[model samples]
Target: MNKALPMSGVRDSTYIPENILSVPPNLSMEAAMKETEEVIFGAIVSVLAKTKVECSEIGILIVNCTLFDPIPSLTSNEGIV
Candidate 1:
């Protein structure tokens, strides 16, 4: 069975320019969630392409995040499944 594994990567704050502080923090949680989902899905697609796995063949997907826990849910896998 094919599997999709979602892994985490680190972003360096040093890459941000000094003038970035001028930007407003008008970020919505929904926007953040959509961006994150797109990123994760892209990563999964890349891995699947490299491994010759079909989308329909996927049996499971595993994701791990340190922050942003779901309310009343110990693990996020429940939402994915």
Candidate 2:
């Protein structure tokens, strides 16, 4: 029985990251976190690079992630260098 849909009407796309998002035995939490850190830091750097604000100029850093809601939050995971 051929039961493969045409993948139609899928609005959101969370399963697109080929490097970060992968199944077990192929991807590890550490690697995933590292990739995530790179992405986030890249974004921040991109924005900061565009502006005249320096890293020291930044006062408050706001990080919002609702996955691991407990001690040592997402923001605690240091960004890329």
Candidate 3:
């Protein structure tokens, strides 16, 4: 809370703990993979809910990530198509 400290520049709209400006020391490959699965599955479900498209109706799936390409691939991890 001291003005002498550099923390005064922090933005009111920004959350320091939740933001990913710097990776946490405990971050690991397993955690990254779990997050990837959650993201992929959540997005697929969101699209299906909006479009009213059945899961079986989906013929092909494509995945694109900035810096993540797991061993089995992203879509394959979903397993439900």
Q: Pick the candidate with the highest TM-score.
A: 3
User: Candidates' lDDT values, in order?
Assistant: 0.53, 0.59, 0.65
Listing every candidate in turn, what is its Cα RMSD in Å to the true structure after a full C-alpha superposition? 11.5, 5.1, 6.7
Per-residue lDDT over 12-77 for candidate 1, one digit per residue giving the tens place of the 0 to 100 score: 433322233336743554544544566567788899889998989977666654443445433343
Q: Would you estimate the TM-scores of all the predictions?
A: 0.52, 0.56, 0.58
Which residue runs does candidate 1 get wrong by more than 4 Å?
1-22, 67-81
Q: Name the candidate, 1 or 2, with the larger TM-score value.
A: 2
Query: Where does the lowest 10-residue lDDT sum fall in candidate 2?
Result: 1-10
TM-score (C-alpha) between model 1 and the true structure: 0.52
Candidate 2, 58: how far from true, in Å? 0.6
Candidate 2 stretches greater than 4 Å from native: 1-15, 20-27, 66-71, 78-81
Question: For residues 1-81, what per-residue lDDT tens digits would candidate 2 score against the true structure?
Answer: 133333544334543444534554336556656656766687788999899689998888886544324346666555422
Ranking of models by TM-score: 3, 2, 1
**lDDT at 60 for candidate 3?**
83
TM-score of 3: 0.58
